[model samples]
Target: PTLTAGTVKGNTAGAFGYKNTITTDNSYVVGSNSTISADNGMVLGNSATVTGANGLALGNNTKVANDNAVAIGNGSETAAAG
Candidate 1:
């Protein structure tokens, strides 16, 4: 994966997008129809998209931002874990 290009299309374990992803890239899309672009990020969607270094989109249209983060479902943002 480059600064924005990682796909994990639909399957079973995950309705779409990436469910159990792990790595250090830029962007990552894990859905049947989604897009990602970031640095060390992840996205999981059915038809979503993401744009940015270290971002992620996960869902039908999720989106993410920042590095070492992750988005789940269509669009979103990786909030600091507690």
Candidate 2:
């Protein structure tokens, strides 16, 4: 489903020219051409990406670690002690 724009308290839209399929709880994100797979993570920018749980992300063209990691910023990333 194409979740459009809104200050929705629960659901949000996908990035521009993209699709939003993953579902999560307690997270925030914005912008286009980005990705995330966090259960309680957040992002607010363009071309950002992540594929982990309980993580948070921000900035443009960024990547995150998997398995309970937190990523932040473009070309800036990190991983947790898992």
Candidate 3:
């Protein structure tokens, strides 16, 4: 069961944009081409991605790739877990 406005798949996750996808429980994705693939992850900008549990990515092309990490600002990326 997912709440979606675009391409999405997850148990109780939400995705709301073109090509957005959430693939883990309690995750959320928004903006075009964004993706969230871990539990409690969230992405909220174009091309943003979150690939670790409890991670967050916010801004264009931002990425969070470790557990409890957060990436903010355009083109930002996390280099280590939080």
Candidate 4:
């Protein structure tokens, strides 16, 4: 079952923050303005985003845009899969 705790979208669980969104199953997002758009993605921190399957983004302004990618720390971005 999906468990959403704040303003969010999609079939996901453990989302808890304002304006956070998860667009695929098995995704989790936390922090304001965060978004996860792929399956098995996880994002944490303000303005973090995950756009690829099995991606992870952590810290403020972090982004992971490729499958199996991970981005951590503020202003981090992943450009290739790992």
Candidate models: Cα lDDT each: 0.45, 0.57, 0.82, 0.80
lDDT of 3 by residue, 4-55 (tens): 4565567778777777877788888777888888899988889988887899
| lDDT computed for candidate 1 | 0.45
Q: Please give, for residues 1-82, the per-residue lDDT of candidate 2 as tens digits.
A: 2345423233552332343334555555666555656666566666666667666666777767665666665777766675
Which of the predicted structures, 2 or 4, would earn the higher TM-score when compared with the native?
Answer: 4
TM-score of each: 0.41, 0.58, 0.85, 0.82
Top lDDT prediction, candidate number: 3
Off by over 4 Å in 2: 1-22
Question: Where's the lowest-lDDT run of ten residues in candidate 3?
Answer: 1-10
In the range 1-82, model 1's lDDT, one tens digit per residue, is 2223333332321223333333334334454555543344455555554455556565555655444556664345556556
Local error of candidate 1 at residue 69 (angstroms): 5.2
Ten contiguous residues minimizing lDDT sum, candidate 4: 1-10
Q: What is the lDDT of residue 38 in candidate 4?
A: 82
Residue 11 alpha-carbon offset, candidate 4, angstroms: 3.7
Best by TM-score: 3
For model 4, the stretches where C-alpha displacement exceeds 4 angstroms are 1-9
Clashes of each: 30, 0, 0, 0
TM-score: model 3 vs. ground truth: 0.85
Arranged by TM-score with the best first, the candidates are 3, 4, 2, 1
State the lDDT at 74 in candidate 2: 70
